[model samples]
Target: MVEVADTAVRAGLSGPRHPADPARRREARAGYGLMSPALLLMVAVLALPLAALIVLSFWTQSGFTLDRTFTLANYWRLIAPSDREVEWMGLTFRLAYPVPAILIIKSLVMSLTATVAVILLAYPMAYFLAFRVHRNKAAWIILLTVPFWTSYLLRVFSWKVVLGYNGAINSGLMSLGIIDAPLEFLLYNPAAVTITLAHSWVSFIVLPIYVSLEKIDRSMLEAASDLGDSKWKRFRRITLPLSMPGTISAALLVFIPTVGDYVTPELVGGPGGTMIGSLVQQLFTKQNNAPLGAAVSLVMMLIIGAMVLIFLTLIGYWRMRARRAA
Candidate 1:
């Protein structure tokens, strides 16, 4: 046994010096060398901005000048009530302090709603593209993506026109005698904002799910059928589980942007649809509260980070359970 162990150690040490081993090592080094540039680019472009945001969160800026002093005042103000009094619209409004928890909760609700809506719509579309549609898929995908080629702002504005009282939808409905007058509850609401956002983000969700579903082997379905499984059974037991990673990915993609979005809520939401993003913008632009705005921005980032971490943890736990069961 000692001789065998000694021989194994010798073999391991000398393995890389062999003709084939040198070639394999060279290939491995080349692959890593090629990836190094991309890794550096990510660190510069993505990581740096996040780090700067974190630093800015702790910083206090007075007017155009930035103070490099680090203090917990920004974070403290976020949680503690402010004694400052202010007037708005002829009424005295107290700056009773902003609750970070409330903002975080509202952002989560909005993001989660939009994500769920996108997933619901994307799942059927992805399933159809993967299993039902074979011919003209490229053309169909192009058609789906054509909306993106146009200005995002224009697309959002178009929804406003459609939902407006004097807009095409109301006009058509009124002409058809579907209603006595234009519906007042259609636009300038949370529903409109959510719908517009979900519609705009549908492509993001569909593309990832379609890619995942496409990678699934056709033989797996046939094999399940051969074992007397119905379509629903096969989808529930096999397809849904396999496609979960894509769903989770799609949720992240939709949720992140929606949470930070100021445009959709501003354009469509009017008053009732005001999100934390709008609140942050108000602090910076209207109120000129840089320190407060920075605090809010930092809190928003932390909330988003927590959400992402929770989602990733859940996905990891589910994956581990599935692996163990398998």
Candidate 2:
């Protein structure tokens, strides 16, 4: 009896296997295996390059060759009080202790101006497309995106011709007797750079805002109207506030790129149009100073990062407040 009981107990102790556990384990393995390729690609494409840049930014270089030694000289040089002008590739460069400061301010101003202009221009256009022009919405959206098919370089260069001294505006003004001489202010200035960048990136700002605005429920607006809200009041209290997310997102998209743009400044910005990006390019290509260039790039990255963080924080705070109020 005892021997039989022991055998039975042992058999009972060997519990039934869980089919779900093995199935779950297999599924998890398959999911990870599928994702591994994409994960590796991301690491190779983005992570590795970013890590290399960070490392290179700290390394000293001589005549395009990097030194293995680590040094703080690159960062220190940013604020080095030197009256001696650094000349590279026949262009004389002076270190203004305040150059970085000025660059940040200028970049922000230009970006803000461009963002505001895009929002103002895009809002009405987007609204018209979303609410009023529903018959051919897809066609209109395609038309809006058609500019992207053209080469960005060509489009920007075309502006040079349009805004040149002997260009379209000058000819038109002359034909109409609006001016006796060609206006020099038409191109190669900060204003020209701002205008060109705004035109180039207008679509980026418009598309996102349009999508967001289009998603807004018309019933909400109708409810506001039914609740005795005036047209202006409805827009102010409802339409504008609800559209804040799109506006904020558009501002971010425009501001981030415009702040780092070198091409616009080089092409349209004549004398006083040099930004931090131009400085970085000079360091890398002209001066053959990779460390210094890296430092500048890192600084620019930090500035943009800070701006993004602040914008996100503000958005979060506003969202929380809005939710609480609701």
Candidate 3:
């Protein structure tokens, strides 16, 4: 028995198992079989459309005609510098196409603003649910989600009615004699768009954050308190760091989709509040420039991907420093 045990250990430590092993091959085949359906769905839903978009971006459109011949004109038009220049903050930029560039910047700024607002507003609610609520917690979660149960369009329209020049807010103010006239600046602006986006996405952000806060080990918190740590210090050192995963996830969930949202912006965002998604819609539908629209769509997607990568990198660096300090 001793000899047999020693022989088995020696064989196990000899080297890693070869990939050509029959058992390993069988497991790989089974795993692939299990994943085949999802893989097929991804290919049909995501890959094919992406390939078509890429192919379309290389082609040019003329009056009711799509030139199937490949050319770089569409891409060149996006990047080709114009004679025009704009100066901001003591720096001059020779813009390629000012319209698209401006719209992209506007979309990013609005999206980031909305994302930050969502996080700030959501954290307190999530904390309350996680820590303060002991009874009927499920009911509270249901109540939080109730607003989202209604149609998204209805919600936006409701905000419109509230914020419109002669809407609820203005009417209430007039009735109370707080102001003689309605506030025209309440609706149909970038602020309106940002507000709508933040409110629309806040409920979804709460669940993840709540789950994160709930999962924190109680013993560590208690230990901190016993060791003379204040409530804020405990939260700052332990709760905040631990809950970052959910907070970051919630931010991404809000940021990515809102950046590409055209409907909310279109309804609330007047001409001055237009975003890159609105431009893509116009190019595809109104302007009949599918190639250029496809190019813009691809560019927007690339920018979003890059931004998400940078955000993740920054978060990872922060986590590394925190871990080192600990």
lDDT of 1 by residue, 1-326 (tens): 22344687996776566657767778768867998999899999988976776777787777777788998777887676556655432544344664444555666687789889999999999999999998999987887788899888998999999999898789999999999899988899878888999999997679889988998899998998899999999999889987877777778888988998999889989887778888788877887666667778878887788868877777678789978998
Q: Per-candidate TM vs. native?
A: 0.80, 0.82, 0.90
Give the 10-residue window scoring lowest on summed lDDT in candidate 3: 1-10
- Clashing pairs for predicted structure model 3, backbone only: none
Which 10-residue span in candidate 2 carries the lowest summed lDDT? 11-20
* Colliding pairs, model 1: none
lDDT of 2 by residue, 223-286 (tens): 9999999988998988887777777777777888888898888887887767778878888899
Compare the candidates by TM-score and give the number of the best one. Answer: 3
Model 2: CA > 4 A from native? 1-38, 81-98, 319-326
Q: Top lDDT: which candidate number?
A: 3
Error at 113, model 2, angstroms: 1.8
lDDT of 3 at 281: 98
Per-residue lDDT, model 1, residue 23, is: 79
